[model samples]
Target: MATPRSRGPELEHDVGRTPSLGYEPAGSYGSVRYLEHGFPNPLVRWHYHEEYELHLIVATRGKVFVGDYIGQFEPGHLVLTGPRLPHNWISTDVPEPGVALRDMVLQFGDAPLRQAAALIPELAEALPLLERARHGVEFFGLSEAARERFGRVRAAHGLQRLAEFATLLDLLVRCNDYRLLSTVQLQSFDDDAALAHISGIVDYLIEHYSESFSMAELAQRSGMTESSFSRNFRRATGNSYTDFVNHLRINKACQLLMETDRYITNVCYDVGFNNVANFNRRFLQIKGMTPKEFRRQAEARFGSAA
Candidate 1:
């Protein structure tokens, strides 16, 4: 269990149509590329690439940002992000010397797999998993196995590496303890300008969820009328303006409840809710539990720092 910190200026720059990283692996490995990198490196940033990424965190706990999804991640946090999906992981509890091996990644293009799936029925089994990855997928109870498979993939070459990669995919495809992370599929956005605007707004709201504001104010700031903003916002985030804001506030309340020793009423107000009843209602609606219940469960699972 990891605690979250406020987004800093570095994180603000990471929002909105993030810079794309060019990954052209040249080797005998063919379609699949395996990579491992440490923290505090240039490669660790808010970025996107054209290939699907199977990411496994091997060390350190932090907050993970994928599209509009914000959550805590620790070692053994496994996620698969689809092509062009923006993502970043920021570690808040770094030692003075920093971690040397924080991530293990496998990158591959969909075109090769889809093309092969047309010829090989066995490969086609992975198509749905890739499709679900468009919104990002987090796999649970597979970290140790995934780490072993990743090692096998990294050690093999040519068709052998491809086979190892397919085996890893097979494991993920069959796993039922997985959750889709992002509510909206960013690739579904046809308008680049609208995507950028909505992304910026989302970043602002994530950072300032405790502050009070209205959709009308945000609409005006974006230079769009209320009606136009409403339509575009829903299209971009898959939630109405009010629902989106409430989601952010509830998410923050969850973090507070898990990591801090605050009263339920104080936690509610701290996360922008004016009333305890409304906060409790939204918490149950979004998280499927009351704040007190959530705190108790989190403490039992992770042993609260407070």
Candidate 2:
């Protein structure tokens, strides 16, 4: 819970119209793949894959964006996302740059679930869980036993990995402390032309979040009129341009306020807000607390900022 250092040159968060599809090759052992990533890495981008993913946040706290849903996450945060659902987590409290272990992820294809169901008919009952995962599911307050189950899966190998995976799924399928993210099913496109324009725009905005731009400029870049660009952006992201930019700024401010020693006034300007009063208002609207209160509470929980 230490305050994250100033984001500096790092991108605050990632958002793109076309979610990048990720591929994980099956290792010599099994089809299921296990991955652990440290912060300030390249994988923390707005992307999706054909395989379903079960993700665990092992360290740090941050805001998680899955499809159109926006929320916060901390250590032990667990989420299951079905194929083609876009998701990313922006760590708000990584005290150093380089690398910090922050996530444990398991990814597998629907074929395995089908094969398991065919071998053990009763396993078919769990198929609904995969269907529900299309919208992404977040399990809150994982029981110690559940966490232990996740650890077993992470530590297992070969056939044992497969077994642990089944056990973990069974435990989660029966749990009721979870909620679905993504209010609706998002449509997918195979054509790169359809996504490239908006994706470029989103990438640019994320990289240059602290700067100001205009609709005319963005529209020109996208090869669309102002009205059409605005309409499509909202449709694709579920956020208007202003709100989308604000979301990025506020989350970046959260990291700076908690991790860095910068003054609130400086933090506000550093994150791209022109006025402290307006920054305070937007921070409260997004985080339900003023910057000072947030920093204080974070320190209390983490035993003082670094």
Candidate 3:
């Protein structure tokens, strides 16, 4: 067993072919892999695999997309996504773009966990935690402790790595500061295959979220009837088309508020809202506060950090 390094990039033999949503991590060394990624890695795209992932945002503030849930993320943030849940984290420009280490990740398959749980009563208690991870979990409290465990796990090997992994899971399972992200269950392979085409449409929306596109245009592009596309899109993403677009707009609005001194109205329109009143209404619905309040709190947080 080899000790993991802080700056260890993926070796050439450590990668496998990527499927539509994401690639399978090659478990060449062990069943559990501690992988790190910089900002500009190819794995940054929206993707999924059979291996469950425990991810830590080591640096950068960004908007994370897990299923239909879009929210802000910063350093020390920890999230767990179960097998086959599509997700991506897009970094904002607060810390510049050249940071080489943005994420510390761990990927392991469920079979080994279940096998171990069958023999260990305490490990069996973690089954519920893994079940809950099907919807994705963002841990809030125990952050510092969890961060320390992540560092330890990243540097350990052999039995030590497995021990640290179990400790990390125990902390997360008992923590009260976690929230389930997606509203739906894990999608089947066929469902994911069907949604692979929809992933392209999602990519387009992410790229051109501020621009307006007609339902007919989207339907034509997806080669489905408007009604059929709407149904499938909701089934895949857990949001209506309008609500999905609004979430994207609001996420952009959050980035602008956190990073710039722009007025709330300008920020709203810059993210594609046609009216300040509607923007404010939707923003409050999604974020639980007025844009002005959000900006004030964000500024306070950053200012204190600085």
Best model number under TM-score = 1
TM-scores of all candidate predictions against the true structure:
0.57, 0.52, 0.54
Model 3 agreement with the true structure over 212-267: per-residue lDDT tens digits: 78877987898889998888788766788888888888877876765566677778
- Cα error, residue 285 of model 2, in Å, equals 14
The RMSD of every model to the true structure, in order and in angstroms, is 10.7, 11.7, 12.6
- Deviation (Å) of 280 in candidate 3: 15
Where model 2 places Cα greater than 4 Å from the true spot, the runs are: 1-26, 184-306
Model 2: per-residue lDDT, tens digit, 171-226?
Answer: 77888888877542222345456356767788888788888788799999889888
> Once superposed on the true structure, which residue ranges of model 1 sit more than 4 Å away at CA?
1-25, 184-306
Off by over 4 Å in 3: 1-14, 17-28, 94-97, 184-306
TM-score of 2: 0.52
The lDDT of model 1 is 0.78
Better of 2 and 3 by TM-score: 3
Model 1 pairs whose backbones collide: none
1 versus 3: better TM-score goes to? 1
Which candidate, 1 or 2, would have the higher lDDT against the true structure? 1
State the number of backbone clashes in model 3: 1
